[model samples]
Target: MKVDPGTLDWKDAYKLLIGSVLPRPIAFVSTVDRDGHCNLAPFSFFTGICANPMMVCFAPMIRGTDGKKKDTLSNIEATKQFVINIVGEKIAAKMNDCAIEYPPEVDEFVQTGLTKIPCEFVKPPRVKECDVHLECTLHEIVTFGDHPGAGSLVIGRVVYLHVLDELFENGKINSEKLRPIGRMAGQTYTRAVSDTFELERKKQPGK
Candidate 1:
Protein backbone atom coordinates (compact mmCIF):
# COMPACT_ATOMS: atom_id res chain seq x y z
CA MET A 1 0.00 0.00 0.00
CA LYS A 2 1.17 3.53 -0.77
CA VAL A 3 1.38 5.61 2.40
CA ASP A 4 1.87 9.37 2.69
CA PRO A 5 4.52 10.35 5.21
CA GLY A 6 3.01 13.77 5.71
CA THR A 7 -0.11 12.23 7.16
CA LEU A 8 1.73 10.04 9.65
CA ASP A 9 2.98 11.15 13.04
CA TRP A 10 6.66 11.32 13.88
CA LYS A 11 6.53 8.05 15.83
CA ASP A 12 4.82 6.32 12.94
CA ALA A 13 7.39 7.67 10.51
CA TYR A 14 10.21 6.35 12.71
CA LYS A 15 8.52 3.01 13.03
CA LEU A 16 8.08 2.75 9.27
CA LEU A 17 11.68 3.66 8.57
CA ILE A 18 13.15 1.26 11.10
CA GLY A 19 10.80 -1.53 10.14
CA SER A 20 11.77 -1.30 6.49
CA VAL A 21 15.48 -0.56 6.94
CA LEU A 22 16.18 -4.18 7.91
CA PRO A 23 19.11 -4.72 10.22
CA ARG A 24 20.91 -1.42 10.13
CA PRO A 25 24.51 -1.34 11.25
CA ILE A 26 24.88 0.12 14.69
CA ALA A 27 27.51 2.77 15.32
CA PHE A 28 28.53 2.33 18.95
CA VAL A 29 29.80 5.85 19.10
CA SER A 30 32.15 7.13 21.80
CA THR A 31 32.76 10.80 22.32
CA VAL A 32 34.14 13.29 24.83
CA ASP A 33 33.01 16.71 25.90
CA ARG A 34 35.30 19.74 25.95
CA ASP A 35 35.90 19.15 29.65
CA GLY A 36 37.00 15.55 28.87
CA HIS A 37 33.90 13.78 30.07
CA CYS A 38 33.32 10.56 28.18
CA ASN A 39 30.06 9.39 26.61
CA LEU A 40 29.05 6.30 24.72
CA ALA A 41 25.90 5.65 22.73
CA PRO A 42 24.56 3.77 19.75
CA PHE A 43 23.02 5.00 16.51
CA SER A 44 21.51 2.60 14.01
CA PHE A 45 21.32 5.13 11.19
CA PHE A 46 25.01 4.65 10.44
CA THR A 47 26.86 3.75 7.29
CA GLY A 48 29.97 4.32 5.24
CA ILE A 49 29.65 7.25 2.89
CA CYS A 50 32.95 7.53 0.94
CA ALA A 51 35.95 5.29 0.54
CA ASN A 52 38.31 7.77 -1.05
CA PRO A 53 38.66 9.81 2.14
CA MET A 54 37.42 7.02 4.39
CA MET A 55 34.32 8.87 5.46
CA VAL A 56 31.39 7.54 7.45
CA CYS A 57 28.18 9.06 8.77
CA PHE A 58 25.57 8.52 11.45
CA ALA A 59 22.30 10.32 12.05
CA PRO A 60 21.37 11.22 15.63
CA MET A 61 17.75 12.14 15.81
CA ILE A 62 16.30 14.59 18.25
CA ARG A 63 14.70 12.90 21.25
CA GLY A 64 11.04 12.14 20.69
CA THR A 65 10.46 12.56 24.42
CA ASP A 66 12.35 15.83 24.96
CA GLY A 67 13.32 17.06 21.48
CA LYS A 68 16.86 17.62 22.76
CA LYS A 69 20.13 16.51 21.24
CA LYS A 70 21.75 13.34 22.53
CA ASP A 71 24.92 13.41 24.52
CA THR A 72 26.86 11.89 21.66
CA LEU A 73 25.83 14.73 19.33
CA SER A 74 26.58 17.40 21.87
CA ASN A 75 29.99 15.90 22.69
CA ILE A 76 30.91 15.65 19.04
CA GLU A 77 29.84 19.23 18.51
CA ALA A 78 32.05 20.35 21.36
CA THR A 79 35.20 18.33 20.65
CA LYS A 80 34.80 17.51 16.96
CA GLN A 81 36.01 13.95 17.52
CA PHE A 82 34.49 10.54 18.09
CA VAL A 83 35.17 6.85 17.67
CA ILE A 84 32.72 4.48 16.04
CA ASN A 85 32.99 1.08 17.64
CA ILE A 86 31.57 -1.89 15.80
CA VAL A 87 29.10 -3.86 17.91
CA GLY A 88 29.67 -7.58 17.96
CA GLU A 89 27.62 -10.31 19.55
CA LYS A 90 29.95 -10.49 22.52
CA ILE A 91 29.33 -6.87 23.48
CA ALA A 92 25.71 -6.59 22.45
CA ALA A 93 24.33 -6.50 25.97
CA LYS A 94 26.64 -3.74 27.09
CA MET A 95 25.92 -1.83 23.92
CA ASN A 96 22.23 -2.11 24.63
CA ASP A 97 22.81 -0.67 28.07
CA CYS A 98 24.16 2.46 26.42
CA ALA A 99 20.92 3.10 24.57
CA ILE A 100 19.36 4.46 27.74
CA GLU A 101 18.79 8.18 28.04
CA TYR A 102 21.39 9.10 30.59
CA PRO A 103 22.31 12.55 31.69
CA PRO A 104 25.20 14.32 29.95
CA GLU A 105 27.55 13.69 32.84
CA VAL A 106 26.90 9.97 32.84
CA ASP A 107 29.54 7.71 31.31
CA GLU A 108 28.15 4.65 29.64
CA PHE A 109 31.50 2.90 29.60
CA VAL A 110 31.73 3.14 33.35
CA GLN A 111 28.05 2.43 33.80
CA THR A 112 28.18 -0.72 31.70
CA GLY A 113 31.60 -1.82 32.95
CA LEU A 114 33.07 -1.79 29.45
CA THR A 115 36.75 -1.25 29.01
CA LYS A 116 37.80 2.07 27.52
CA ILE A 117 41.19 2.49 25.95
CA PRO A 118 42.94 5.51 24.54
CA CYS A 119 43.01 6.20 20.80
CA GLU A 120 45.98 7.40 18.78
CA PHE A 121 44.49 10.13 16.58
CA VAL A 122 41.40 11.19 18.48
CA LYS A 123 40.68 12.28 21.99
CA PRO A 124 37.76 9.94 22.52
CA PRO A 125 38.58 6.50 23.85
CA ARG A 126 37.71 3.29 22.05
CA VAL A 127 35.61 0.42 23.30
CA LYS A 128 38.12 -2.33 23.84
CA GLU A 129 35.42 -4.96 23.61
CA CYS A 130 34.60 -4.24 19.98
CA ASP A 131 36.64 -5.93 17.29
CA VAL A 132 36.90 -2.80 15.13
CA HIS A 133 37.04 0.89 15.89
CA LEU A 134 37.10 3.90 13.61
CA GLU A 135 38.58 7.03 15.13
CA CYS A 136 37.09 9.97 13.33
CA THR A 137 37.11 13.76 13.27
CA LEU A 138 33.91 15.59 12.55
CA HIS A 139 33.66 16.64 8.91
CA GLU A 140 30.24 18.23 9.05
CA ILE A 141 26.82 18.15 10.74
CA VAL A 142 23.72 18.75 8.65
CA THR A 143 20.57 19.20 10.69
CA PHE A 144 17.23 18.40 9.11
CA GLY A 145 15.00 20.09 11.67
CA ASP A 146 14.68 21.17 15.29
CA HIS A 147 11.58 19.18 16.17
CA PRO A 148 11.39 15.73 17.67
CA GLY A 149 12.36 12.80 15.42
CA ALA A 150 14.47 15.16 13.28
CA GLY A 151 17.95 13.88 12.48
CA SER A 152 21.32 15.53 12.09
CA LEU A 153 23.66 13.77 9.73
CA VAL A 154 27.06 13.73 11.36
CA ILE A 155 29.75 13.13 8.75
CA GLY A 156 33.14 12.07 10.01
CA ARG A 157 36.44 11.27 8.33
CA VAL A 158 38.21 8.23 9.71
CA VAL A 159 41.71 9.18 10.77
CA TYR A 160 42.67 5.90 12.32
CA LEU A 161 41.44 2.32 12.52
CA HIS A 162 41.79 -0.36 15.16
CA VAL A 163 40.95 -3.89 14.23
CA LEU A 164 41.37 -7.17 16.02
CA ASP A 165 44.18 -9.24 14.52
CA GLU A 166 42.09 -12.39 14.40
CA LEU A 167 39.26 -10.61 12.59
CA PHE A 168 41.52 -9.28 9.84
CA GLU A 169 42.40 -11.73 7.06
CA ASN A 170 43.77 -11.16 3.57
CA GLY A 171 43.29 -7.37 3.94
CA LYS A 172 39.61 -7.90 4.67
CA ILE A 173 37.52 -8.48 7.75
CA ASN A 174 36.48 -12.03 8.58
CA SER A 175 32.78 -11.67 9.25
CA GLU A 176 32.46 -15.10 10.73
CA LYS A 177 35.13 -14.35 13.26
CA LEU A 178 33.98 -10.81 13.93
CA ARG A 179 30.37 -11.87 14.52
CA PRO A 180 28.94 -8.40 14.11
CA ILE A 181 25.38 -7.52 15.06
CA GLY A 182 22.87 -5.16 13.49
CA ARG A 183 19.91 -3.29 14.90
CA MET A 184 16.37 -4.36 14.12
CA ALA A 185 13.09 -2.73 15.03
CA GLY A 186 11.91 -2.64 18.64
CA GLN A 187 14.25 -4.68 20.78
CA THR A 188 15.43 -6.94 18.00
CA TYR A 189 18.83 -7.54 16.43
CA THR A 190 20.26 -9.63 13.64
CA ARG A 191 23.59 -11.43 13.61
CA ALA A 192 25.77 -10.91 10.58
CA VAL A 193 27.71 -14.16 10.85
CA SER A 194 24.69 -16.44 10.95
CA ASP A 195 23.09 -18.15 7.99
CA THR A 196 25.12 -16.12 5.56
CA PHE A 197 25.33 -16.60 1.79
CA GLU A 198 27.53 -15.31 -0.98
CA LEU A 199 27.03 -14.70 -4.66
CA GLU A 200 29.47 -13.52 -7.33
CA ARG A 201 28.66 -10.15 -8.83
CA LYS A 202 28.01 -10.25 -12.56
CA LYS A 203 30.42 -8.42 -14.84
CA GLN A 204 29.35 -5.50 -17.02
CA PRO A 205 27.41 -6.65 -20.11
CA GLY A 206 29.97 -5.49 -22.69
CA LYS A 207 33.06 -5.94 -20.58
Candidate 2:
Protein backbone atom coordinates (compact mmCIF):
# COMPACT_ATOMS: atom_id res chain seq x y z
CA MET A 1 0.00 0.00 0.00
CA LYS A 2 1.35 3.39 -1.04
CA VAL A 3 0.53 6.18 1.40
CA ASP A 4 1.39 9.79 0.80
CA PRO A 5 2.09 11.83 3.91
CA GLY A 6 0.91 15.03 2.19
CA THR A 7 -2.45 13.49 1.46
CA LEU A 8 -3.09 12.10 4.91
CA ASP A 9 -4.30 14.23 7.80
CA TRP A 10 -1.89 15.16 10.56
CA LYS A 11 -3.34 12.71 13.04
CA ASP A 12 -3.27 9.81 10.59
CA ALA A 13 0.26 10.58 9.52
CA TYR A 14 1.36 10.84 13.13
CA LYS A 15 -0.18 7.47 13.88
CA LEU A 16 1.62 5.89 10.95
CA LEU A 17 4.93 7.34 12.02
CA ILE A 18 4.58 6.18 15.61
CA GLY A 19 3.37 2.71 14.67
CA SER A 20 6.24 2.10 12.27
CA VAL A 21 8.90 3.32 14.65
CA LEU A 22 8.91 0.30 16.93
CA PRO A 23 10.13 0.45 20.51
CA ARG A 24 11.41 3.99 20.58
CA PRO A 25 13.39 4.86 23.69
CA ILE A 26 11.48 7.32 25.84
CA ALA A 27 13.07 10.43 27.35
CA PHE A 28 11.23 11.54 30.47
CA VAL A 29 12.18 15.18 30.28
CA SER A 30 12.19 17.50 33.27
CA THR A 31 12.50 21.28 33.22
CA VAL A 32 11.70 24.40 35.23
CA ASP A 33 10.30 27.80 34.42
CA ARG A 34 11.86 31.10 35.51
CA ASP A 35 9.70 31.16 38.62
CA GLY A 36 10.93 27.61 39.40
CA HIS A 37 7.74 25.85 38.40
CA CYS A 38 8.62 22.24 37.62
CA ASN A 39 7.43 20.43 34.53
CA LEU A 40 7.80 16.75 33.71
CA ALA A 41 6.88 15.06 30.49
CA PRO A 42 7.71 12.10 28.28
CA PHE A 43 8.92 12.28 24.70
CA SER A 44 9.77 9.33 22.46
CA PHE A 45 11.23 11.39 19.64
CA PHE A 46 14.60 11.25 21.32
CA THR A 47 18.04 9.80 20.60
CA GLY A 48 21.74 10.29 21.12
CA ILE A 49 23.43 12.36 18.46
CA CYS A 50 27.21 12.37 19.02
CA ALA A 51 29.72 11.07 21.54
CA ASN A 52 32.64 13.45 20.95
CA PRO A 53 30.93 16.28 22.81
CA MET A 54 28.17 14.14 24.27
CA MET A 55 24.98 15.33 22.60
CA VAL A 56 21.34 14.26 22.64
CA CYS A 57 18.18 15.44 20.87
CA PHE A 58 14.45 15.26 21.41
CA ALA A 59 11.63 16.66 19.28
CA PRO A 60 8.70 18.18 21.15
CA MET A 61 5.79 19.09 18.95
CA ILE A 62 3.24 21.86 19.34
CA ARG A 63 -0.28 21.05 20.45
CA GLY A 64 -2.54 20.23 17.55
CA THR A 65 -5.51 21.85 19.20
CA ASP A 66 -3.91 25.15 20.18
CA GLY A 67 -0.60 25.16 18.30
CA LYS A 68 1.24 26.13 21.46
CA LYS A 69 4.58 24.71 22.46
CA LYS A 70 4.83 22.32 25.37
CA ASP A 71 5.99 23.50 28.79
CA THR A 72 9.24 21.61 28.46
CA LEU A 73 10.08 23.42 25.24
CA SER A 74 9.22 26.80 26.71
CA ASN A 75 11.32 26.17 29.83
CA ILE A 76 14.25 24.90 27.85
CA GLU A 77 14.01 27.93 25.62
CA ALA A 78 14.00 30.31 28.56
CA THR A 79 16.54 28.67 30.86
CA LYS A 80 18.62 26.87 28.24
CA GLN A 81 18.80 23.85 30.54
CA PHE A 82 16.92 20.63 31.00
CA VAL A 83 17.35 17.01 32.06
CA ILE A 84 16.52 13.86 30.15
CA ASN A 85 15.52 11.03 32.45
CA ILE A 86 15.52 7.54 31.04
CA VAL A 87 12.28 5.78 31.82
CA GLY A 88 12.22 2.32 33.39
CA GLU A 89 9.52 -0.28 33.76
CA LYS A 90 9.19 0.31 37.51
CA ILE A 91 7.95 3.90 37.12
CA ALA A 92 6.19 3.47 33.80
CA ALA A 93 2.77 4.16 35.24
CA LYS A 94 3.85 7.40 36.89
CA MET A 95 5.61 8.44 33.71
CA ASN A 96 2.41 7.89 31.79
CA ASP A 97 0.53 10.03 34.25
CA CYS A 98 2.71 12.95 33.20
CA ALA A 99 1.33 12.74 29.70
CA ILE A 100 -1.65 14.78 30.81
CA GLU A 101 -2.02 18.28 29.36
CA TYR A 102 -1.83 20.18 32.57
CA PRO A 103 -1.54 23.95 32.86
CA PRO A 104 1.90 25.56 32.91
CA GLU A 105 1.72 26.16 36.66
CA VAL A 106 1.09 22.49 37.39
CA ASP A 107 3.92 20.48 38.92
CA GLU A 108 3.92 17.06 37.31
CA PHE A 109 6.32 15.57 39.83
CA VAL A 110 3.90 16.44 42.62
CA GLN A 111 0.92 15.37 40.56
CA THR A 112 2.43 11.99 39.65
CA GLY A 113 3.93 11.51 43.10
CA LEU A 114 7.47 11.14 41.75
CA THR A 115 10.51 12.26 43.61
CA LYS A 116 12.70 14.97 42.11
CA ILE A 117 16.43 15.13 42.65
CA PRO A 118 18.49 18.26 42.24
CA CYS A 119 20.66 18.22 39.14
CA GLU A 120 24.25 19.36 39.36
CA PHE A 121 24.45 21.64 36.34
CA VAL A 122 20.87 22.27 35.21
CA LYS A 123 18.13 24.15 36.96
CA PRO A 124 15.70 21.34 36.28
CA PRO A 125 15.46 18.43 38.68
CA ARG A 126 15.75 14.81 37.66
CA VAL A 127 13.25 12.11 38.31
CA LYS A 128 14.60 10.01 41.16
CA GLU A 129 12.52 7.08 39.98
CA CYS A 130 14.36 7.03 36.68
CA ASP A 131 17.68 5.24 37.00
CA VAL A 132 19.58 7.45 34.53
CA HIS A 133 19.63 11.21 34.19
CA LEU A 134 21.33 13.32 31.55
CA GLU A 135 21.89 16.92 32.56
CA CYS A 136 21.96 18.97 29.39
CA THR A 137 22.30 22.51 28.12
CA LEU A 138 20.38 23.66 25.12
CA HIS A 139 22.55 23.54 22.00
CA GLU A 140 19.97 24.41 19.39
CA ILE A 141 16.30 24.15 18.49
CA VAL A 142 15.39 23.35 14.88
CA THR A 143 11.79 23.76 13.94
CA PHE A 144 9.83 22.02 11.19
CA GLY A 145 6.31 22.66 9.98
CA ASP A 146 4.59 25.96 10.68
CA HIS A 147 1.11 24.79 11.57
CA PRO A 148 -0.29 22.97 14.58
CA GLY A 149 1.39 19.66 15.40
CA ALA A 150 4.60 21.20 14.13
CA GLY A 151 7.82 20.03 15.80
CA SER A 152 10.87 21.66 17.23
CA LEU A 153 13.88 19.42 17.56
CA VAL A 154 15.76 20.39 20.71
CA ILE A 155 19.46 19.55 20.59
CA GLY A 156 21.22 19.46 23.94
CA ARG A 157 24.79 18.85 24.96
CA VAL A 158 25.10 16.47 27.87
CA VAL A 159 27.05 18.13 30.63
CA TYR A 160 26.56 15.49 33.31
CA LEU A 161 25.14 11.99 33.70
CA HIS A 162 23.85 10.20 36.77
CA VAL A 163 23.43 6.46 36.53
CA LEU A 164 22.35 4.00 39.16
CA ASP A 165 25.42 2.23 40.58
CA GLU A 166 23.89 -1.20 40.43
CA LEU A 167 22.87 -0.83 36.77
CA PHE A 168 26.51 -0.45 35.77
CA GLU A 169 28.41 -3.67 34.97
CA ASN A 170 32.04 -3.85 33.98
CA GLY A 171 32.21 -0.88 31.53
CA LYS A 172 28.67 -0.72 30.24
CA ILE A 173 25.09 -0.48 31.45
CA ASN A 174 23.46 -3.86 31.97
CA SER A 175 20.17 -4.03 30.09
CA GLU A 176 18.83 -6.66 32.47
CA LYS A 177 19.22 -4.26 35.37
CA LEU A 178 18.20 -1.08 33.55
CA ARG A 179 14.96 -2.59 32.30
CA PRO A 180 14.07 0.46 30.21
CA ILE A 181 10.64 0.94 28.77
CA GLY A 182 9.95 2.00 25.18
CA ARG A 183 7.08 3.92 23.55
CA MET A 184 4.71 2.66 20.90
CA ALA A 185 1.60 3.91 19.12
CA GLY A 186 -1.72 4.64 20.80
CA GLN A 187 -0.92 3.94 24.43
CA THR A 188 1.26 0.94 23.61
CA TYR A 189 4.64 0.40 25.20
CA THR A 190 7.43 -2.17 24.97
CA ARG A 191 9.81 -3.64 27.52
CA ALA A 192 13.28 -3.30 26.02
CA VAL A 193 14.89 -5.86 28.32
CA SER A 194 12.55 -8.65 27.31
CA ASP A 195 13.17 -11.16 24.51
CA THR A 196 16.56 -9.73 23.76
CA PHE A 197 18.87 -11.00 21.05
CA GLU A 198 22.42 -10.37 19.92
CA LEU A 199 23.83 -10.47 16.39
CA GLU A 200 27.49 -9.97 15.60
CA ARG A 201 28.29 -7.50 12.87
CA LYS A 202 30.11 -8.94 9.89
CA LYS A 203 33.38 -7.44 8.66
CA GLN A 204 33.67 -6.20 5.07
CA PRO A 205 35.40 -8.57 2.64
CA GLY A 206 37.86 -5.86 1.53
CA LYS A 207 38.88 -5.27 5.13
Candidate 3:
Protein backbone atom coordinates (compact mmCIF):
# COMPACT_ATOMS: atom_id res chain seq x y z
CA MET A 1 0.00 0.00 0.00
CA LYS A 2 1.19 3.51 -0.87
CA VAL A 3 1.17 6.10 1.91
CA ASP A 4 2.07 9.75 1.90
CA PRO A 5 4.70 10.52 4.49
CA GLY A 6 3.29 14.00 4.98
CA THR A 7 -0.13 12.63 5.97
CA LEU A 8 1.22 9.85 8.21
CA ASP A 9 1.69 10.29 11.94
CA TRP A 10 5.14 10.15 13.47
CA LYS A 11 4.53 6.73 15.03
CA ASP A 12 3.38 5.26 11.71
CA ALA A 13 6.36 6.69 9.91
CA TYR A 14 8.69 5.38 12.64
CA LYS A 15 7.20 1.91 12.40
CA LEU A 16 7.69 1.71 8.66
CA LEU A 17 11.15 3.23 8.83
CA ILE A 18 12.49 0.95 11.58
CA GLY A 19 10.93 -2.27 10.26
CA SER A 20 12.38 -1.75 6.80
CA VAL A 21 15.77 -0.70 8.22
CA LEU A 22 16.51 -4.30 9.30
CA PRO A 23 19.26 -4.87 11.90
CA ARG A 24 20.77 -1.65 13.24
CA PRO A 25 23.91 -1.32 15.29
CA ILE A 26 23.30 0.03 18.76
CA ALA A 27 25.30 2.77 20.49
CA PHE A 28 24.94 2.72 24.26
CA VAL A 29 25.81 6.35 24.81
CA SER A 30 27.17 7.74 28.07
CA THR A 31 27.41 11.36 29.04
CA VAL A 32 27.65 13.46 32.19
CA ASP A 33 26.13 16.70 33.34
CA ARG A 34 28.17 19.59 34.69
CA ASP A 35 27.74 18.14 38.17
CA GLY A 36 29.16 14.74 37.13
CA HIS A 37 25.91 12.81 37.11
CA CYS A 38 26.30 10.18 34.39
CA ASN A 39 23.60 9.22 31.87
CA LEU A 40 23.37 6.09 29.76
CA ALA A 41 21.00 5.38 26.86
CA PRO A 42 20.93 3.32 23.71
CA PHE A 43 20.25 4.51 20.16
CA SER A 44 19.70 2.20 17.19
CA PHE A 45 20.31 4.92 14.63
CA PHE A 46 24.08 4.83 15.02
CA THR A 47 27.09 4.14 12.78
CA GLY A 48 30.66 5.11 12.01
CA ILE A 49 31.05 7.85 9.40
CA CYS A 50 34.76 8.31 8.50
CA ALA A 51 38.12 6.62 8.93
CA ASN A 52 40.81 9.29 8.59
CA PRO A 53 39.41 11.32 11.45
CA MET A 54 37.54 8.36 13.00
CA MET A 55 34.08 9.82 13.32
CA VAL A 56 30.80 8.30 14.53
CA CYS A 57 27.20 9.46 14.18
CA PHE A 58 23.99 8.74 16.07
CA ALA A 59 20.49 10.18 15.75
CA PRO A 60 18.74 10.78 19.05
CA MET A 61 15.08 11.01 18.10
CA ILE A 62 12.63 13.22 19.92
CA ARG A 63 10.57 11.58 22.62
CA GLY A 64 7.32 10.24 21.16
CA THR A 65 5.12 11.42 24.01
CA ASP A 66 6.49 14.88 24.80
CA GLY A 67 8.27 15.54 21.51
CA LYS A 68 11.21 16.77 23.58
CA LYS A 69 14.85 15.86 23.45
CA LYS A 70 16.30 13.06 25.58
CA ASP A 71 18.82 13.39 28.40
CA THR A 72 21.64 11.98 26.27
CA LEU A 73 21.34 14.87 23.86
CA SER A 74 21.06 17.43 26.63
CA ASN A 75 24.17 16.14 28.37
CA ILE A 76 26.17 16.08 25.12
CA GLU A 77 25.28 19.66 24.37
CA ALA A 78 26.23 20.74 27.89
CA THR A 79 29.42 18.71 28.23
CA LYS A 80 30.57 18.59 24.58
CA GLN A 81 31.65 14.96 25.03
CA PHE A 82 30.31 11.43 25.42
CA VAL A 83 31.23 7.79 25.16
CA ILE A 84 29.85 5.12 22.81
CA ASN A 85 29.72 1.76 24.53
CA ILE A 86 29.18 -1.37 22.47
CA VAL A 87 26.31 -3.45 23.80
CA GLY A 88 26.10 -7.23 23.97
CA GLU A 89 23.28 -9.66 24.72
CA LYS A 90 24.39 -9.96 28.32
CA ILE A 91 23.89 -6.25 28.94
CA ALA A 92 20.65 -5.81 27.00
CA ALA A 93 18.44 -5.80 30.09
CA LYS A 94 20.55 -3.19 31.87
CA MET A 95 20.71 -1.17 28.66
CA ASN A 96 16.91 -1.22 28.41
CA ASP A 97 16.60 -0.11 32.02
CA CYS A 98 18.69 2.97 31.33
CA ALA A 99 16.34 3.84 28.44
CA ILE A 100 13.59 4.60 30.94
CA GLU A 101 12.32 8.16 31.21
CA TYR A 102 13.59 9.40 34.53
CA PRO A 103 14.13 12.86 35.91
CA PRO A 104 17.12 14.76 34.58
CA GLU A 105 18.64 14.86 38.04
CA VAL A 106 18.54 11.08 38.41
CA ASP A 107 21.76 9.32 37.60
CA GLU A 108 21.32 6.42 35.18
CA PHE A 109 24.64 4.80 36.06
CA VAL A 110 23.50 4.42 39.64
CA GLN A 111 19.93 3.42 38.69
CA THR A 112 21.08 0.71 36.31
CA GLY A 113 23.78 -0.58 38.73
CA LEU A 114 26.43 -0.14 36.04
CA THR A 115 29.95 0.88 36.87
CA LYS A 116 30.85 4.33 35.57
CA ILE A 117 34.55 4.52 34.85
CA PRO A 118 36.42 7.71 34.15
CA CYS A 119 37.50 8.41 30.58
CA GLU A 120 40.98 9.65 29.80
CA PHE A 121 39.98 12.39 27.37
CA VAL A 122 36.27 13.12 27.97
CA LYS A 123 34.36 14.17 31.03
CA PRO A 124 31.74 11.43 30.51
CA PRO A 125 32.32 8.01 32.03
CA ARG A 126 32.38 4.70 30.16
CA VAL A 127 30.35 1.61 30.91
CA LYS A 128 32.74 -0.80 32.59
CA GLU A 129 30.67 -3.79 31.52
CA CYS A 130 30.82 -3.00 27.83
CA ASP A 131 33.60 -4.78 25.95
CA VAL A 132 34.51 -1.88 23.71
CA HIS A 133 34.15 1.83 24.40
CA LEU A 134 34.96 4.88 22.33
CA GLU A 135 35.56 8.18 24.09
CA CYS A 136 34.64 11.03 21.77
CA THR A 137 34.36 14.78 21.57
CA LEU A 138 31.35 16.51 20.07
CA HIS A 139 32.05 17.42 16.45
CA GLU A 140 28.70 18.77 15.34
CA ILE A 141 24.94 18.65 15.97
CA VAL A 142 22.59 18.80 12.98
CA THR A 143 18.81 19.11 13.12
CA PHE A 144 16.78 17.24 10.56
CA GLY A 145 13.70 19.49 10.30
CA ASP A 146 11.69 22.24 11.95
CA HIS A 147 9.36 20.00 13.94
CA PRO A 148 10.13 19.11 17.54
CA GLY A 149 10.01 15.46 16.50
CA ALA A 150 12.91 16.07 14.14
CA GLY A 151 16.12 14.17 14.95
CA SER A 152 19.36 15.59 16.26
CA LEU A 153 22.28 14.02 14.46
CA VAL A 154 25.21 13.98 16.92
CA ILE A 155 28.59 13.58 15.29
CA GLY A 156 31.60 12.70 17.45
CA ARG A 157 35.29 12.47 16.79
CA VAL A 158 36.91 9.46 18.38
CA VAL A 159 39.66 10.37 20.87
CA TYR A 160 40.24 7.13 22.78
CA LEU A 161 39.28 3.49 22.23
CA HIS A 162 39.14 0.98 25.08
CA VAL A 163 39.06 -2.70 24.16
CA LEU A 164 38.91 -5.67 26.45
CA ASP A 165 41.84 -8.01 26.15
CA GLU A 166 39.79 -11.02 25.07
CA LEU A 167 37.90 -9.20 22.30
CA PHE A 168 41.05 -8.22 20.46
CA GLU A 169 43.88 -10.28 18.99
CA ASN A 170 46.69 -9.00 16.77
CA GLY A 171 45.20 -5.87 15.15
CA LYS A 172 41.57 -6.92 14.44
CA ILE A 173 38.59 -7.40 16.70
CA ASN A 174 36.93 -10.81 16.98
CA SER A 175 33.19 -10.54 16.44
CA GLU A 176 32.47 -13.79 18.22
CA LYS A 177 34.48 -12.76 21.22
CA LEU A 178 32.96 -9.31 21.20
CA ARG A 179 29.53 -10.90 20.73
CA PRO A 180 27.98 -7.52 20.02
CA ILE A 181 24.19 -7.28 19.77
CA GLY A 182 22.22 -5.30 17.20
CA ARG A 183 18.64 -4.01 17.25
CA MET A 184 16.02 -5.48 14.93
CA ALA A 185 12.46 -4.47 14.03
CA GLY A 186 9.92 -4.30 16.80
CA GLN A 187 11.17 -5.74 20.11
CA THR A 188 13.76 -8.06 18.68
CA TYR A 189 17.55 -8.17 18.49
CA THR A 190 20.40 -10.22 16.99
CA ARG A 191 23.82 -11.44 18.13
CA ALA A 192 26.98 -11.49 16.05
CA VAL A 193 27.74 -15.19 16.13
CA SER A 194 29.39 -17.72 13.79
CA ASP A 195 31.35 -16.85 10.67
CA THR A 196 31.02 -13.99 8.18
CA PHE A 197 31.80 -14.40 4.49
CA GLU A 198 34.00 -12.13 2.39
CA LEU A 199 34.20 -11.56 -1.38
CA GLU A 200 37.34 -10.38 -3.14
CA ARG A 201 36.92 -8.10 -6.12
CA LYS A 202 38.27 -9.60 -9.36
CA LYS A 203 40.28 -7.73 -12.00
CA GLN A 204 39.53 -7.97 -15.74
CA PRO A 205 42.45 -10.15 -16.90
CA GLY A 206 45.97 -9.75 -15.47
CA LYS A 207 47.91 -6.52 -15.94
Query: Residue 60 lDDT in model 1?
Result: 97
Q: Which stretches of candidate 2 lie over 4 Å from their true place?
A: none
Across 1-207, the per-residue lDDT of candidate 1 in tens digits comes to 789987899899889999998789999999999999899999999999988899999999998878899899999999999999999999999999999999999999999999999999999999999999999999999999989978899999999999999988999999888899988898999998788898999998999
Local error of candidate 2 at 154, Å?
0.5
How many backbone clashes can be found in candidate 2?
Answer: 0
Residue 38 miss distance in model 1 (angstroms): 0.4
Each candidate's TM vs. the true structure?
0.98, 0.97, 0.93
Which candidate ranks first by TM-score, i.e. highest?
A: 1
Q: After best superposition, candidate 3 residue 70: deviation in angstroms?
A: 0.6
Which stretches in model 1 have alpha-carbon errors above 4 Å? none
**Which scores greater on lDDT, model 2 or model 3?**
2
Give the alpha carbon lDDT tens digit for every residue of 1-207 in model 2.
789987888898898999898779999999999999999999999999999799999999988878888899999999999999999899999999998999999999999999988999888999988889999999999999757757999999999999899988887888898899898888888899888899999999999
Lowest lDDT block of 10, candidate 3: 143-152
Clash pairs for candidate 3? none
Better of 1 and 3 by lDDT: 1
